[model samples]
Target: MDATPPGWPEAVRPPGAPDWERTAVAWLFDLVPPDYRAHEVLRRYPVLLARFARDHVAAGLEAARSGWRTVRVELADHLPADAMAAAMTAYEREGARLAAAARGVAVVSAALRGERWVPRL
Candidate 1:
């Protein structure tokens, strides 16, 4: 029986499980820019790292959504019809991926904050 909530990242073990925080930190780091790895403060403070990861994921999700909303208007004239359609499809796929990443980040952030998931019937 897995205790992890839906959308919980596979890279992170369930909260309260052995080494879960360490795994969570590693997983969170993977979500952020590679440059974030150079920050000693973020590495020393997992909670702070989680916060940064949350914000970063949120920004990515927003960017994807914004691009999807405007790509047609911005590129319709410049791109062929098939290319424009492909761009829209690309945006939609990326937006969905980012949205899922956002959810995973939220769950990891909550766990890092000491929140535990309790399954309900």
Candidate 2:
């Protein structure tokens, strides 16, 4: 009976479930830098925290993509073929992870902003 969209983070309960917002806040905090937890405003404002998480995830995704694009060219002479292959693999994995995180953050942020999801036919 879970109504959450695909890519919804397992750590965040479905919106409107008991203590969901608290769970969401905790999940969102995990996406941002550790230093972000020190900001009282972010702790007090879940919506803002969600925005921060979204931005952080987006930046990470972009960074991974950029690295993937340039790593082979930038390090071709500096590293062996095995190391280059590993760097490409790392970037690919990170891009996928951040893409999922971005999706989860988007839905969580929408929920925090009072937007509810209705089932579609």
The stretch of ten residues in a row with the least summed lDDT in candidate 1 is 1-10
How many steric clashes does model 1 contain?
Answer: 0
Q: lDDT by residue for model 2 over 11-108, one digit each (tens)? A: 99999899999999999998989999999999999999998888899999999999999988888999999999899999999999999999999989
Residue 14 displacement in candidate 2 (angstroms) = 0.6
Q: What lDDT does model 2 reach? A: 0.92
In Å, residue 101's CA in model 1 sits off its true spot by 1.2
- Could you list the CA RMSD of all candidates, in the order they appear? 1.4, 1.0
How would you encode candidate 1's per-residue C-alpha lDDT over 21-85 as one tens digit per residue? 89988998998999999999999989999889888988888888898899888888899999988
Score candidate 2 by TM-score against the native.
0.96
Q: Best TM-score goes to which candidate?
A: 2
**Cα deviation in Å at residue 116, candidate 1?**
1.0
lDDT of each: 0.87, 0.92
